[model samples]
Target chain A: MSIFSNLGIRGSILGLAAIVTGIGVTRSCDGGGIVTSQHRVDLTFWNGFTGPDGRRMLEIIRDFNRENPDIQVSMQRMDWATYYNKLMVAAMDQRGPQLFVVHASTLPRMYRSGFIENSARLYSGSDPIPSADYDPYVLQQVKFKDQYAGVPLDIHPQGMYTNAEMLRAAGIQQPPADKASFMRALRLLTKKSNSGDASQWAFALTLWRNNFQSLIPQFRGRYLKPNGDADLNNPGNIAALQFLGDLSREKLIPPPENGLGWVGYRQKKVAMVWDGVYMLGDLLRLQGLDYVAAPIPQIGPQPGTMADSHVLCIRKGLSEAQRTGAETFIRYLSKNSIRWAAAGQVPARRSVRQTPEFASMPVQSAFARQIPFMMYPPRTPVLFEVTLEIDQAVEKVIRGNADAKTALDLANVNAQRGIDRDRAEQKIAPAGGIQP
Target chain B: MQRTGFLFLAPYAVSFAIFVILPIVVSFVLSFMRFDLTAQSSAGFVGFDNYREALQDNYFWSAVKATLLFALMIVPGLLVIGLSMALGMNAMARGQAAVRALVFLPGMLNIAVTGILWQWFFNGEFGLFNFALKHFGGQGQPWLSDKAFAMPSIVLMSVWWTVGGTAIILLTALQQIPGMYFEAAALDGASTTRMFRYITLPLLKPVMSFVVVTTSIAGFQMFGQAFMLTRGGPELSTRGVAQYIYETAFNSYRMGYGAAMSWLLFALISVFGIFQIRMMRRPA
Candidate 1:
């Protein structure tokens, strides 16, 4: 009888342990992860629309959830910096979201990291997003080593935004047509000893990675050689740098110290600046400022522009039913991304791009003109590192801290080493193996 | 005696062995291997190649230089100011508790918020630093735009936020110095500086060593301020080992390389940590 009672106690302890394990497993599955049941499809959707855009996204997700309660879609919104970090961690752990958003430039890195699903079957055979419905350039941006997978969501291209009153005061009747015209425009608009002398400057450029890369193409210089080495040391690149350096040095534009591009333009201290549709919300809120958007004037023999986009992808680990749910949810979002366009993005779907709504938005439409000529940095696994290297080089050059050639040379050396390191890393995967 | 000692140590031994010792050993060994961060995994024995490459790489050395520069800037400054505050607090002054809390408040604030606040404060156009300069009938110099100013800005921000914790530690050490010691110094007709030098400095060495080692370790681990404020820029002037490690691990997904950096940084910190340990055990 005593032995029976001891056996009963051991059995009860084992049952409690099992119960604890069940709860642990439930927490991962009930909301943010793969569903246990084949009958109930749970979807995890991630994006970086944490701005005012997030509210609209939440509303859309709410509508979707209300209509299709069977397929529960959990909208995970993180900030831009942390969004990618979380996705990469989830992918590394082999328990990622069913669907997520990433920049077009970042897609290559994600693909290489095995954070993205490579199989065509996941989204190809009868998936709601047909390949033909996307703009070719936008579609091309999300391809992984020539393997197209990410459903392109939006196009965010760099364009010239001007303060109309400032431009008119400079006696410029029209926006500049070419590099020379642009230079003259800059010279005319920029007034140093003017009324707001110490406080204001004119014709500010948002000099950073996006705008830096955009300027390269305008100088008739390539950002990268066909062999994938940086081409910033070329003569065209030199001339372009000199012109920009001259602008800041000669007092035709604000020095690196005056980092008031968007704000100065909005407040009417500056005449012109270049940025993406992301800044449209800032402009829309500005009052009493007569502003207009225009296609950036040709900088070189080739008319090149900066266009970045966000690509939606799936995490590596999930059941077959979960993958299907994720794909369906991506298709649903892509189909209904027009609401997203109203918030600032140009819808990635071609049909949506051709609609009256897209045509009506002046800034978005002007930004869209350069779609065929748009370029991003090399879509490699090391692209993000390369961008950092470029930023270092650009800062040195812009601050007059280092010459353009020396800075570019240093950048090239660093980029090459990064590429080599990346190759070495890819050659050595850790542990035995992780499941898909 | 043996049995009682074992009983007292068993739980701690088990925990230390599991959490600390195991991870340290595994990671140390793993540092000499190569691995990818992904669902599909395979690891290769890399020997001392990761360390060799890190030594040879300019970026790594640049990171090292930046870290050392940061350590040099923060460590002594933190100690001097912290101990000074502690001395002030050790006196039975009015509002001592309130002053301690006020001094300690910055350390409790989030690093991200601190960076943003400082960024605005240092902004050339609308920043408070420039605003104050204009008030003095002076020109606004770029506080964070110039590479020279960038490092100083980050260091200043870090100093403001962290000195409080260090002060608290020093204050406790001051309290423990004993009223009898001070009275004895008074009897000897020793000046205030002499008392601090002879009595206070020697007794405080233990806690001083503790403060130095922990702060040194934290100095190398600086990331959020650089990441948030200048992004290690104006031109990579402010990037440190922790930021580089993070970029490698998460941004690049080169987990093996990142691990290699971690162990390398561990060795770097340990060398300093051991020195502090020796200093504490010294004849003084």
Candidate 2:
């Protein structure tokens, strides 16, 4: 009797395990088969838009699905910090989404990995988004080695956000437009407490990298030389660094630290801060705070600011039908990007920007004025490493640990070493031309 | 009966091979190759070149230094603080269970939650700590921004988050010690300190050694706390080797180099493990 009962238990356990495995396999296979059997093209879209913008994108995706029954587009969103790592791994394993988003600045690295399709071919479809419809500078961002690498969706530039209440208390009506006026405003708005600590300030360097990058271009600081070497310590860049360091040295800005500078501005403790246009939605959600946006003040000799775009890219290795479907979805998103603009981004297409709907977004309109002169970081495959070096140098100078010149010189050496290593690994001949 | 037992173990054995063993084996092979994901066509056997580069890399050395400094801070803190809490709990006359449960509660919170909560507390401008300090006529210190304070702040959060579980383990071991031994020591005119040092500690040696080794191992592998808190910053002063490896491999796409560093870290942990075992072993 005991032996018979044990046999019965073993049979049931085996049956249960087999049933579970079968269900798992069949469920996954069923998803694919049902779509394909109906002659529908299934497209997976991935992006890192886990904010208010994510909701906007989801609504658009829903509209697209309802409008286009032939294509099934599934969207997945994650935080941007870990998104690129996950995307690259998925692409490497050939299990990537059919459609995805890549930052224009990250195109070169993604391109080098051979996963991005030549998006120029996407224009061959019906109802294509004309190349001329996009802002030229914005279009140039997604172009790599004479090929259009991705479709530009929106441009997010670093601009000045001001506390109107604090500025009014300081007797400033208009934001600074140029370098001299900016310095005057800084002096006028800065205040000290009884303990000799800065209680209110004209400006806070929120993202030091973007702040430095914005200043560098205004000073005509070239990050890369014609010879493909890093020029981080050039005269223009050093002057920009000195300007930033002076802000800290003069107690116009707080020390480079962990405090949320934006929070200070929202609470009316800070007069102004330089952040990206993406912060518009956040500020709008904050009630009882009077804030406004303006073009970044001319800290250098000319007008310029740092900007990057979210580009739509199709994964390689898709079927012809899948490719066509992905392109159709991208073009649809581009055509209707005024919806995207409501989520606090400047649409990349000039036609879209010129529309009445986009004009009504006051914050987007202010930031969009600088689209003609927005500077992206150097378009290198090793951009991440280069930016790390830049950030380290900028932090050292701002924190008063090292002088601007010394820090930049060290950073120059480090950046050049990284670029040289990258070049050697790729087997590109140094300086002049390719090896014979 | 034999067949049924084998069948019962097969699922776990299969998963272990596929998930754990396979990755280790693949990474070992990858460490010897030139596996740059961006330029995959150029991948080939480089035979220890990745390891050689790591030895000469300044960033790698800095990362190693940060990891060691963090381990040194957290391990001893965990041991001392955890033991004190355990001793206190063991000496309690009533509500010991409730107290033990309360002590272990923080460990149940997720690492990300712990990090975010502490980040708010450590914020220099408008943080809770700074607000309290200002009320007392004191100035706020740059807790997460200064290189000197960043790691210590991370350690403080880690102790609050992790020491609870360690204390519970120690408390369990403490409860196992016979009350008669302590009674005898007291009857012999032994002081409380002497009783603790001579009777309690000697009995708790094995558990203590286990705790030390495990905490040290966990400390060396620290990533999430520092990643979320300082982001290896105030100038990469808090970037541990694990974060460095992550950036190198995934961010830079230098898989071979990253795998090489991973092995180097593993070797480092093993060396510490051996040394700790030797030091903690009871006299033969």
Candidate 3:
């Protein structure tokens, strides 16, 4: 300070300022060198392909990462058990993966929840797929409230499996084509002579919901009309219910206690079953099991069969670049859907189905044929509630909980109430929307 | 001494506070809000609304009924099977360990695997169960798909997988009983059944209480069998509360509602659980 008094206070202040500036400049440079201006983007993809399917998806993702160095995409394959959990967390946190795969059947809730984006923008302006290229039913299945909420990937329809050996032994050389033939084939195949006098169905039905829903279209029944309203009381629905009841009553299908359809079919205990394509992998592994896939033989007035689809969709609210990247990946999978077929699903791209490569595959092509006729449940936001009630009601009916009409009637009531209540609640919901 | 005790509990306190207490508090609070999955950060308070909706939900009730039904069928049966097996094994000293391991081995496998394995076993035709029934001249029953039979079938599978665990627990309890009890009963001219009823059962009460409550809790949260085998079908007969909450929170993106349902189940379990706790506190 004595030296500073001679030099003046300003000189000392200048020295202090210079030192502080030098330190700040050095720190800024050190930090900025690493984080300067190179922006890195993360694209997260979430899916529930926790099997060989998951591994295949991983391989594809690995290739994608290898090819693209700038954008890093992280693929998370989760078990179905906690998939929705992961999605919900991501959604609630507003850090959702850029892309995700969802079962088409459950997307209604996702759509209503606003977890998915309307992707029509890509296809609207001169998309490769002519609207006519898609199956009418599937085209319809892809929408929610007139918005193209999802992009279709695969149709995992219910196929009636014929135990070849059992059917042949029953003197049936050909699988049933319709209700009459189905009855005859079943009658000939099922022999209760071993189990009991009372036991009639040599056929067993498992996972009655799948069995019932698939039959809904056959009976000209739908869980609801297209716009999320109850249509259980419709004649088509009734006819389907009657057939199911008749099948149970006539002992054409065993009450669930007996090995249900797949178990019974694999064991060669039952001659027939209606099950999803997902059952193919398990059936293929059954040591002595030999079965053939066929259309769930049109039992009702319409030839339509029931099914659930797996959809590939972009998570809502991604950036333009992320959306573009996601669209690229989605298109890649859609084109290369044959890989998905190995996982026991029917791919959605019409070209995939027509390919000699795909058609030659034993079950994929035959099952794929049913895609055109496959009936998805109505694409209503409240589809889950309606389906759940119908499923429960159907079970009770089959379990003799109620008569076919009465059961369905009650189911109708429950479905409407659920739809109504859900709408009312949705209306009242703080406008932020569904979390996952 | 109190300080030492506090020091000893420090690690547990930190873990419990972080893992259990914090998550519970978060879940409870989240249950009151309208959680938006797509909004990223848009959540607002909607107090008691989720609770009201969940309470009004028929499927929620269906799930509750199903879960209770599962507990009702499985808990008692598991306890009985476990005790019987434990007693049977205890009486056999030669291959006891081997038999014990064999009985307990299924529990070691996952529930999904167990579900699949038993799906085959209880299968109508090729299932070992129906196969045995047929071999024994009994009628084959549709085990997994029949609404009337599906839940019971699941209970049967659950017991098969879990009886081993209960057996192990009860076996530990049985072993803890001094040899003198059995010897005294034998000298007192007690029949095997009488000895079990009077002496063995009375001594096994604590284990029984533990086994019952634990098994019931497990049964109440039953998911794998329903998820893997029936998928809450042959109708929602097998739809347990856990599946419902899981689906609502995750599948439906209805976190608030799911939280509400879970709390409801929590309350239900607490009522049953408190009784078990009280029973276990009895002076033995």
Q: Quick one: best lDDT, which candidate?
A: 2
By DockQ, the best candidate is 2
Model 1 docking tier (incorrect/acceptable/medium/high): medium
For residues A1-436, write the lDDT of model 2, one tens digit per residue.
Answer: 6554766987878877998898767534533112454568778899999988998899999999989989989899999988998888887666778788999888878888888888887655567789988878788778776678889999999999988877888788988888888898899898888888778878888888899988887888878887678899998899899999888887678776637578778777788899999998889788888887999999888888999999999877776677888888998999999999999999988999999988888899999999877888877787888899999999998898888889999998988888888787788766842111
- Using lDDT as the yardstick, the better of models 1 and 3 is 1
Error of 3 at A38 (Å): 7.1
User: Cα miss at A142, model 2 (Å)?
Assistant: 1.9
Would you list the clashing residue pairs of candidate 1?
A218-A299, A218-A300, A429-B42, A430-B36, A430-B42
- Which of candidates 1 and 3 is the stronger one according to DockQ? 1
User: How well is each residue in A1-436 modelled by candidate 1, as lDDT tens digits?
Assistant: 6654766987878877998888767745543464646577777788888877777778878887777766788888988888888877775666667778888877766776665775455346765467788777677677655466578878887888887777787787777768888888876666656435534455777856666777766767655555554555677666656556666666666777766877778878888888887788777766888888877778777776777787877776566667777777667778888877777777888898888988998888777777777776666666777777778777776777777777777777777767656555555332312111
- How many collisions between residues are there in candidate 3? 18
Candidate 3 per-residue lDDT over residues B174-271, each given as its tens digit = 98989898798899888988987788888888778888888878878888888887889866778999999987766555677788778888899989
Please list the C-alpha lDDT of all candidates, in the order they appear.
0.76, 0.87, 0.74
* Interface root-mean-square deviation (Å) of every model: 2.2, 1.5, 3.9
